[model samples]
Target chain A: MEILSLNQISPDQVVLLQWGVVRITATLLYTWVVMAILILVAILVGRKATADTAISRWQNLLEVVVSSIREQIREISQDEPDHYTAFIGTLFLFIGLSNLLLIVPGYVAPTSSLTTTAALAVCVFFAVPIYGISKNGLAYFKEYFQPTFIFFPFHVMGEFTRTLALMIRLFGNIMSHDKVIAILLAVTPLFFPIVMHALGLLIGMVQAYIFSILAMVYIASVTQAHESHGRGP
Target chain B: MHIDWFVFAAQIINFLILVALLKYFLYDRIVKAMDARQAGIASRMEEAERLRQEAGRHLQEMEEKKRQLDARVQEILNQAVRDAGAEKERLLALANEEAQESRRRWKETLAREREAFYDRLRLTSGEIIFSTIRRILGDMADAALEEHVVDTFVGRIRGMDEQAQELLRRSLDDSRSEVTLVSAFELRPDQQEKILSALGPFLSHDVTLRCEVRPELISGIELVSQGYRLAWSVQRHLETLEEAFKEALREELPEVNLENAGGEDAPAQEGSRQPHQSG
Candidate 1:
């Protein structure tokens, strides 16, 4: 457990699967753990969920969470929230659970590992085009050539660069927060490290929310592009 | 920076798996529940609105019924009042009619009673007057009254109106040539001679004289020939006196009344005989 190794930017992972040169890592294991927790809770809460006026405590909590995400999706999408709920909701949950696991001892946050963050960012990168294409068809590509054909390169580069930013932004924040806590604890061995870890928790949730919102914005921009041209949907 | 392509690929695969798993477990179920609850709330609100509209309609119907009931009640009350007023008027008219009939009946009864009382008084007065006069005349009668009556008849004949003289003459013609003289008492021969001499001028020729006494003629004399009745008797005088008294009684008792007093006029002996007839 090389917690304070500045030279190796990615955390040492406990591998889960390996085939010839390909490897599955511990970050994947932790992400799987988060996935299991989310899945199990969803199952129990889903059973508790009722269409009646009165509801159970679990159903009430889940309703609050689901509605809040629905409202956020509606604001960004400016369209129906039904189709986008799953994609945006899964992104927030995965990232939020990864940060939430920080309170457990010896738990390495999957978000704090570059490969894990890059993988999540890569999913968002692919999801934007998928959602945009699904909403507006091939016409969604017109937004890239907007203003002039001269803006085409900048628009194309902007997509990959934003994807890179999404990856680096999450990875840098979680990794640096973890490194600072590790350094504080290695030096002071106590209180300052605990405070910084708590701060890191807040930063982790903020980053997850930012990632989800950005993905939603990207999908909405493409879907709503024709509205600016006075074409009623 | 050390980059491992295999780990990166594995991490990306892991993330895609997480996205898929979470989407299936959490996002799908929760969103479906949320959509169902929204539909339920909308259904509940619509039901509440329907119930409220029904309640309003029911309230309006009730109000209309109440208004009709109130109007019916008022009509009944008005009819009752009208009937009562008409009944009161009919009853009052009946009472007034009954009162008038009773009053008229009472007046009739009173009038009949007054007439009966007057009839009894007249009968009693007649009897008393007749008896009283009979006694007075009986006491006064003798030959003097007869002589005076004979003189009055002679004087009446001398100054008679032509129509009366003719009437008396015609009556005398129709009879047998005889005259009858009645007296209350037996008369002397000389007295009869004087009466006969006094009446001789009115006779057409010689008239045979017949003398008779009637006790009812309490005083004076009466001469009868055919349909001519020349009388100056106490019975006839008494009748005249009773009539005078009845006239006086009628004047005094105007309200009580003695309506029928039979007073036939006497045949007067001209100017001299007028006093006796007037009495």
Candidate 2:
């Protein structure tokens, strides 16, 4: 009745390029579609934004999303409400829009794939420490090994665990929500699919909030800890 | 599940692109709006504080002007009272002088009348004596004897009038003073009678007694006459000493502001000076 598994679409012949002991698989066409759709939405929203006149419908909706995300960012990043606004706001919008792609007929939700969530988590892992370092240079690194010399291992382990947690949480939630909706749709083409879709929207929003909140908390913990250590915010 | 390298690579590229686009475009503008809102709220709060300070300054100015006006009004009233008292004293002196002059004129008229009456009495006595002697011995030489008898009788009458005038002067002296005795003690009727009996020897005038119940005296009595107070109370002496100390402190520390007026940290007693007492 229904396909057992979802298949990945390839546009061209599978080509492998070897250069400098690096093998690169070219899936430019698939990635390009994802990029193009997101860019078109951004351009549409940006074009509708007005300095003087009332905001257009599409822009107004985007503004609400951006403002709500900005609020959470400020709350989580209590030490410097201004600092983490841009990063967390972008995280929320990208994740939200990516989750919304599941409602489309053909396109798979890009965030439901483990690669997408892991990549976002990796960015957060690097960005948080970089902000801490830039804000407080050598001292931020020293704080990771604080309390005692022996607690350094515990702190190091905490960092990896945080990254791993963020990665798994986002991946598990988004994929499960999408998979449940897909299963319900396969069963019936009736009123029940509507319920699953509504649930998907809810889960989509919650996942977006959770991901951005984790990013804010990570960045905030570093900066706040530095500040508590008598350093710059 | 096994990972597909192609799909994973594609997804990673897509994620980066999405982050880049959202960060560059959407987040920046949103943050700017939020910052603008925050700044607007902060400036508004500052404006409110400025307004409150301005209002406080204005209120202080108004209060200062009101105090000055009140002081000026009180000074004017005191000046008016002094002027009225001076005027009254001047009028009273003038009235006393007129009364003195009138009394001098009355005394002179009374002396003249008495002199005239004596002269007439001497003439009458002479006439009467001459008629009687002419009827009996028939001589005008008896007029000298009549004059001697009249002079002796007039001297006796003058002595009696002088004694009556001395008595009137003594009664006037007794009626001039108003004696009011204010006594404070927790004395029973029997104790009050005893105190009155003891005081009777000291007082020369008729005393009007006013007895008061004063629990604070503890064990002793107080007597107030005119502006003078004679108290046998330890509490009164202590209070007097306290007042003297306060006066000394006031002089030594003239700029040591009294606790209440506008100080927030003033003690309750310093702020509220109205004392409550029981009967």
Candidate 3:
């Protein structure tokens, strides 16, 4: 029965190892597998992409999805989405794909564990500063010291807290939904678990949306101008 | 929170790989295609606009040409109308000239016809008067009238003015002159001698005297000495009356044949004939 919790939330399992002191976790393995799958599919679909006036239907689908992502990024940043498309679009694809992959029977959403959620949050945390420094030069740092120099420590806390909140929120929501389903499977073993699975899917998508939007807010706060940075409260 | 920093690093690597894959396969090509399609549509729109402008220019040119053609047509029509008016005027002038010339010719023909009619009337009147006088004098011819004509002729010779008598006297003095006496009636030898004796005073003594009796003289006696003549007859009296009538008619009519209406002319050619030879 605990095989249902066979996500990273389950007991430890490490296949790849380095000497006696080092080891790998299920979270890293699952992440690498999903990453490989995504990359392989992207490469295969990319082979059929057209550059001429008449485009393949597959290319059209890709264009619509990418353009939607660009439009979303533009709405969030209010500046040009030319540079931010890769990061934001990937953030959306990874989270959304990770949530959608949960439809597999024994598979766990990677965000169901705090370790993977923390990893994604950490990536956003580092990406915000790196993008800010690269785009606005010294102006990005000014947002941290805004209003007064005394607020610098508070700005630092806000950054850590927001990243922590993103990780915790995604972990709690996904984990609780899976836990609820697992418990329902034990107690009822019937219709409610199935019903909760559907609800959990809906919550998974919402949590992915929240996580990406929070990341966009953090990045927008630094790299984008104040007047243009109005999205993702 | 059972978290491993090592696994976090691995997940971050996984996320980066996913971003690179999605960007290469989806975002870059899709945006490029969209941009290409947009550029194509813009170029097509520009081409369409250019074609539209060209068509507009062509339409304007055609309209301008049509306007010019219309103006030319109007000018031609006006010119035609003007030519027609000029032709009408010319024709009218020609017709008027022809009408005027015709009227002048008619007037000339009428005047000529009136002159011919007047000439014929004069000729006819002369013939009528001559006929009537000849008939009247022919009806009055008798021996007594003949004796009276001789007496009157002798008395007329006796009553001659001095200048007339001297002209007669000069004629009789010429040696080449011969005295001739003619009568329309036959005269006896006694009458002939009497007529010759009566003319003896005007004639020279050596001048020969010739007496002739001719009924064609129409009751007149003609005595000629050189170029001088003296005679009296009923035909002569009637001729004198016809001359007076012709003079009266001459006052009423501008053209009358007075000379041809009287004297020696008669209806019958042989009814009277007289020739008096002097010189």
Off by over 4 Å in 3: A1-75, A93-119, A138-154, A168-209, A224-233, B1-11, B21-155, B172-195, B205-279
The models' CA-based lDDT, in order, is 0.75, 0.60, 0.73
lDDT, candidate 3, A1-233, per-residue tens: 23434243531244455554455655666666667776776666667665567777767777787788788778988878888888887777777777777777766667776778887888898999998888777667777777788999999999999889988988888878777777788899978887888888788878877877778877887866543443435
Could you tell me the interface RMSD of model 1?
2.2
Off by over 4 Å in 1: A1-10, A14-24, A146-149, A183-198, A226-233, B1-4, B88-279
DockQ (0 to 1) for model 2:
0.14
TM-score of chain A of each: 0.91, 0.80, 0.86
Using lDDT as the measure, which candidate wins? 1
In model 2, state the lDDT of residue B217: 39
> Which residue ranges in model 2 land beyond 4 Å of their true spot?
A1-37, A231-233, B4-14, B30-279
Q: Residue A143 in candidate 3 has what lDDT?
A: 77
- Could you give candidate 3's per-residue lDDT for residues B1-279 as a string of tens digits? 677666667677778878877788767766777887889889989999999999999999999999999999999999999999999999999999999999999999999889767766765786587667677777788889878877777677777779777766776676364677778877767777776677688655755567777765567887665555555655555555555666666776565454553335532322222321111
Candidate 1 chain B lDDT trough over 10 residues, lowest sum: B270-279
Evaluated on the second chain alone, the candidates' TM-scores are 0.50, 0.31, 0.61
Worst lDDT 10-window in candidate 3 chain B? B270-279
